[model samples]
Target chain A: MPLSKAQLLAWLGKLDAVYAAKKEYLTDLDAAIGDADHGINMNRGFGKVMEKLPPVADKDIGTILKTVGMTLMSSVGGASGPLYGTFWMKPGMLLGGKEELDAADFARFVEAGVDGILQRGRPERGDKTMYDVWAPVLEVVKARAAAGDDVAAIVDAALPVGEKALADTIPLQARKGRASYLGERSVGHQDPGATSSYYMLETLRDVLHA
Target chain B: MKKLINAVENVVKEQLEGMALAHPELTVAFEPTFIRRADAPVAGKVALISGGGSGHEPMHGGFVGKGMLDGACPGEVFTSPTPDQMYACAKAVDGGAGVLFIVKNYTGDVMNFEAAAELVAADGIKVQNILIDDDVAVKDSLYTAGRRGVGTTVLAEKIVGAAAEAGYDLDACAALCRKVNQYGRSFGVALTSCTVPAAGKPTFDLGEGEVEMGIGIHGEPGTHRMPIGPVDALTAYAAGQIIDDPAYTRTVREWDGSGWAENTLTDAPFAKGDNVIAFVNSMGGTPLSELYAVYRKLDAVCKEKGLTIVRNLIGPYITSLEMQGFSITLLKADDEILKYWDAPVKTPGLVR
Candidate 1:
C-alpha cells in the first residue's frame, strides 16, 4: 500500500484524533514524573500539522514533512518540539522529491527518522524513553519489509508491537527527559514519550492502510 | 502563578521581545529564545553560547552582553531549548572563528545542545561543548537529575565570555569554562517549594517546620530534610560544607557549641587555608536579608578555618520559580581564574 496525498491528510487528521482520545492518559503519565504537558503538546502540535495540511496537500512527501517539522519547532517550546520535529524532518529529508512512498521506501523513511531520534536524543533502548518503543517498531518494520510484506501487513504487524513496547516502558527505569529527574520514583509510570511514539506510528498505519 | 505576562504560552517570546526593545545594544531571537550581542557576526572572534530552561532569569540570556555570552538560547519554563534554536544562534553568530557551547549538566539540555553542535559541525564550523556539573550535592544517590550546574555557571560564563571577547580560540575558551567548573562547588537549601506557573501550584509539599537541604537550583528534591532552625545554625551548617576545615568546627564547638561538623569535620571534603570564592545565592522567593544571615555564619566559619575569600559573588544568580531558598558556593580559585572573574560583564540579569 502506498500513501496518497489525501491518505496522508486523513492520517494526520486521524493522528490528531488519536492523540486527543489518549490525551488524559498521556497527561496523567506525564504528571507522575514530567511537566504533565505531553498530551497537550502533542495535541497542539498535530492540530497545527492538520491545519497546515490542506495548504500543502499536493506537495512532495519531503516538503510536507519539513513543513510539519518547522511548524512544530516554532509551536512547541519544550523537548517534544525538537524531538518530534527531528522525527518528521529526517523522513522529509530522505523522501525529498518523492511523490509517494512504497512499503520499502516507507520502512527506510521510518528507519531514517529513528536514526535521527537516536542521534538527536541519544537515548538507549531501555532508557525508558521514546526509543524503547521506536527502536522495536523500526526493527519490526525493517524485518517485515525485508521479508517482502506489503505496507498494510507490515504496519499492522508493527502497531501491536509498538503498543506492547509502550506498555513495557512502565516497568523500566527512566534515564532521560523529565521523568529521569524522578529516578526510582519514576518507575511504575508509563513513559509519555513512548505513548506519543505509538500514536505517531499508528497514524502512519492508518494513512497507508485506509 | 500570578506572574506578569500577556499569556502563559507566550511568556518567553514576549520577555525576549521586551529584552530586545529595552536594550538596543543586544539582539534577541524570538522564535527560539536566543540573546546575542547587537554587533554580532563579528569575524575572527569565537562565539560563546549558553542556554537552558527559561525560569532562571538573567542567566544565559541575562549574561549575554559585552563580557559574557555572544548568544544565549532560552527554553520554556524549566525545559531545555531545542537543537534547531541553538543551531540558528550558532549559524547567526558563527564568524570564521568557530563557536563554544556552555551547557548545563541536565540530560535534556546536554542532549539538545549536543544535537545542535553536530548539525553546526556539519556546516564546517568548529564547535566544542563544556558541560558544567558544579553542584556538590550528593551524586548516584538518585531522586533527581544528577548534579545540577548551579552557581558556578555564572562564573564559567563570565570568565569564558571574557576569554572569547579577548580573541581566544574556541578550544581555549571551552577549556577555560571547564577549568572554572572544576574549581567550583555549590550547595543549596530550600526554605520553601517553588510554584511552577503552568502547574499553578508549588512543585513539592514542604511542611512548616522543614527546610530542604542539598537541593538543585531547579526545584528538585534535596538530599536531606531537617526542621527549620535559627539562621545562624543553618548558615554555619551550610558554610561548613564548603569550608570543610576541622579547626573551624573545633573553634565553633569551643565558642558557640553549635557547628554541625564538630565530630565529623575531619571526614569532610574541605581543609584549612583553602582559597575560595564564595557566593550566597537566593532561590527566587528568598530575600537578600536571609542570604546575608547565611553569609554571616559562613564568614565566621571561613575566619576560623584560615580560609581566604578571594572574591565573593552574592545574589540570585540561578533560581527556581519563586522558591524560597538560598545556596552557598565556594570556588577554589587560583590567580588566572580570579583575573577572568574581574573582567567586565554587562547583561540584563548580571551587570558588573
Candidate 2:
C-alpha cells in the first residue's frame, strides 16, 4: 500500500515523537563520542517541524516535506541540520506534485534523499555516520523494489536490517563528524547519527504497520 | 545546573536582546536572528560575516561593529546558525564591493555557510568563504574531522575585518584570512567540563584531579587527558606541544565563483627568530589573573626558543562559555599582517 499525505504527516509526527522520547538516550550516545547535543538538536528540529507542520498539513506531500526540511535546516544547526535537512528537501523537490508514494517511488525517494546527504556531507558509508545506516537500508529497499515488493513488506523487512546496521556502528571507529576526533575511543560507542537514522527508518516501518 | 537564563529555548533570543540593549552600534534582528553593524552596507567596502554557536560570546556577534565584523549570525548554544541567517546577513550588509565569509572549520559551519553562499550568489551577489582550521591539538585529518578552528578565529576576524575596511576587495580579504589560518596554531586545555544550558549538566566529568588536554572550543574532550598539574606545568605542556609541533597538511573546501574548490594548505612549523603574535585565550570561566600567569610562562618559552613576540593579546576574547580552560595561539606575522593587526578599529569584544 502507498502512503497518503495524512500518513506522511503521521510519519513526520511519529518521527518527532520518537525523537522526543529518545532525545536523552541519543544525547547520551552522542556524549560518548560527539559534543553531546545530538538529542537536543534533534528534538529542537523535530519540535519545530511539528509546530510548522500544522499550517501545511493539508498540503501536498512534496510541499509538506519541503516545509519540514526548511524547518529542520533552520532549527537543527549542526552537521545534522544541513545533512538531514537536505535529505528531506531533495526528495520533496523531486517528488513534487505526487499525492502519495508507492513502494518503488518510496525507494527512489530514499535514493534522492541519500544523494542529498552525500553531496552536502561528502561522507562515505562505513564512516560510522548516518550514511552507514541509510546505505544498508537503502540497499535492501532497492533490492526489494526491484523484486516487486510493496512498500509495507519492504519496510517490514528493512527495519531489522537498519537496526542491525545501527548496532553495527558500535564497533566501527568514526571517520567523520566531531566523533571522529575520538579515533579509537569512538569504536565502542554507538554512532549517534546512525542511531538517529535508524529511528527515522523505524518511524517509516511503524507508520506502514499502523 | 545553575545558569542565569530565562528558559532553555529563549536563551539565545534573550541574549541577543541583551546585546541589542547594550550595544546601540549594532542592529539586532530577531525572527530570523542576525546582528549587523548599525551603519552597515558601508558603501564601497566588502562586508565580513562570521558566526557559530551562541555560547562563544564576543565572537562572531560581539565582534560585529565598525572596522570589525559587518555582521554575525548566532546559533543556539554551541550550534552553528542556519544558512538563512547567513544569506540574509550577506544581502543586508553587501556594500556593492561584495561579501567575504569568515567560516570556522566545523562541519556544520562549513555546510551552512556554503549553502548561504550559494543562495546569495544565485541572487547575483558575490560571496567568498575563508575556512579557519587552526587547532593544533588534533594531529591530522585521519583521526579527527580535521583540526578544529579555535582561538585563531578571533585574530583572523580582527585582521581580515581591517583588511576589508581598508578597501581590500573580497578576494584580497579572503587571501589574507586564509594566510592567517595557515600561519596560526592553537592548543587548548580544559580544567573542567562546561554545561550547555540545554544539556543541563556538564558535557563530561573529570575526577577530582583529572583534566582534559587538547580540547576543542565546544567543551568537547581533548585528544588526551592527565591528572591535574600545576598552572605552570599545564601552561608549559600546551605551549610546548604547539611550539614543537610538526607541519600540518590538510585539504579544505572554499568557494570559487562557480563551484566549491579544494585547496591543499600547510601549517609551517615555527622556528627561532620567527616574529609572531602570541594570544592566550580563556575558554570562559578562567580568570584574567590566571591568563596573565599563562602569558608569563608563554612569554618565557618564546624568548628561550628565540621566537620574537612582536605583539601579544591575552584574555577571554574567544570563549567557549563558562568552561574553566585556556588555549594558546601563535600566529606568524608578516609586514602586512602586522600592519592590519595594529590598525585602529572598534567593536564590543575588541577595542584599541
Candidate 3:
C-alpha cells in the first residue's frame, strides 16, 4: 500500500516514542565512548519537531520532510543535527511537490536521503556511526522493494538488519567522532547513534504495520 | 554533574538568554546566536568575530566588548555553529572595515567558518581568517584529528580585538590575530570529565586519582592519562608541553595558516620578541584559586627559561561546564600587543 499522509506522520510519532523509550540506554552508550547525550538530544529535538508539526500537517510529503529537516537542524545538537537533518531534507527534496508518496517513490526517496547523509557525514559502513545501521537497512529496504515486496514486509525485513548492525557496533573500535578519541577504549560499547538509528527504523516498521 | 543548569539540552539557550539580559550594553541578536558590542558599527574599527561550541563560554562571547571580539557566535555545546548563522553574524557585525574571524583548528569549525566567510564575501564584506591550533597534544596523528585549540584563544581574541578597537585596518587586525596565534602554545589537563547536561553523566572516566593530559576545551580525550598528582607537578606537565622551547615556537609559526599575512607589518616581532602573555584557563569545574595556582607555576616556568612574562591574565575565561581541569597558554608578545591587552573591556562574564 502507498504511504498515506497520516501513516507518515504516525511513523514519525512512533519514532519519537521509540527514541524516548531508549533515551537512557543511548546516553549510557555515549557515556562510554562520547559526550553521552545522543539519546536525550534526539528525543528532545524530535519532541520539539512533533510539537511544531501541527501547523504543517496538511502540507505535501516534501513540505513535511523539509520541515522535519529544518526543525532537527535547529533543535538537535552534535552530529545528529546535520546527519538526521540531511536524512529528512534530501528525501523531502526528492519527493518535492508530491502530495503523497507510493511505496516505490518512498523507497527512492529513502535511498536519496541516505545518499545525502553519506555525503554530508562521510561515515563508512563499520565506523561505529549511525551509518552502520542505516546503511544495512537502506540496502534491505531497497532490495526487498525491488523484489516486489510489500511496504510492510520491506519495513519488517529492514528492521532486523538495523538491530543486528546496532549490536555489531559493540566489538568495533570507533573510527569517527568523540569515540575515536578513546582509541582502544572505544571497543566493547555500542554506538549510541547507531542504537538510536535502529529504534528509528524499527519504529518506522511498526508504524507501517499498524 | 553539579552544574546549576536546569537541563542539559536547555543550557545553551538559557545561557544565551542570561547573557542578553545581563548585558544590555551588548547588541545581541539571539536569532543566530551572536553577541555584538553595543557600540558595534564604531566608525573605522574592523569587526572581530569568533565562536565555537557553547561550553567554552567567555572566550568568544565574554570577550565581545572593548579590546576583543566585536561579535561572537555561539553554537550548541561541542558543535560548530552552522555556516548560515555565521554569515548572518558577519553581516550584522560589519563596520564597513571588514571582519576578522578567529577559528579554532577543528575540521567542523574550520569547514563551517570558511563557508561562512565565503558566503559573507559574496556580499562584498571583506573577511579574513586565522586558525588557532595551539594545543600541543597530537601532531600528525592517525588515531586523533590534530592538536586542539585551548586557552590561547582567550589571549588572541584580546590582543587582536584591541588592535581592531585601536583603528587598525582589516589587514592589520588580521595580522595581529595571526601573530598571536603563531606565538601561542597551550596544553591542558582534566581531573574529572565534564558532563554534557543532556547526557547527565561524565563524558570520560578519570579514576579517583587519575588525570587526563593534553585535553581540549570541548571535553575531548587527551594524549595521556596519569595518576592525579600535586598541582605543581600537573602544572609543570602541562606547561612543559606548552613553553620554554624554541622548537615549540617554530611549530607555532609553521602551523599558523595566517602567520604569513603579518609579514606586511614591519613591526612583527614574535620571531624576535621578549614580551609574553600568560593565560591560565579553567575547564569549568575548577575554581579561581586553582587557576591562580596554575598561573603561578606557569610564571615560574617562564622565569626559568629567562623569558619575560610581561602580561598575565588568569581565571575561568573559557570553560567546559564543571570539568575539573585547567589549561595554560603562552603568547610571546611585543610592545604593540601589550598595549591592547590592558584596554578596558565590559561584558557580562568579563568586566575590567
Distance from true location, Cα of A131 in model 1, Å: 1.3
TM-score of each: 0.88, 0.96, 0.80
Residue A107, model 1: lDDT of: 91
Cα-lDDT of candidate 1:
0.77
True contacts kept of each: 0.34, 0.69, 0.11
Model 2: per-residue lDDT, tens digit, B1-352? 9899988889999988988999999999976889999999999999999998889888979899877899999988888889999988998999998899998888888999888888889999989998888888888886568988888999999998888888998889999999999999999999888898988888888777888999998888787889998888998889889889899998888889989888898888998889999999988999999999999989888888889999999989888889898999999999999999999889999998
1 or 3: which has the higher DockQ? 1
Better of 1 and 3 by TM-score: 1
Residue B68 Cα positional deviation in candidate 2, in Å, after optimal superposition:
1.1
lDDT of 3 by residue, B234-351 (tens): 9987777765433432222111232222122111223333667888888877999988888777778777766678878778887887789888877877677778878876666666
Model 2 misplaced stretches (Cα beyond 4 Å): none
Q: Count the backbone clashes (under 3 Å) in each candidate.
A: 0, 0, 3
What is candidate 3's lDDT per residue for A43-146, written digit by digit as tens?
Answer: 87799889978998898888999899877765665667667777888898888778667768868877987886786566777788888888888888888888
Ordered by lDDT, highest first, the candidates read 2, 1, 3
> If the candidates were sorted by their DockQ against the true structure, best first, what order would they fall in?
2, 1, 3
Quick one: best DockQ, which candidate?
A: 2
Write the residue-wise lDDT of candidate 1 on A67-150 in tens digits. Answer: 887677555556677777788888988888888778898798888888878766667888898889999999899999999887
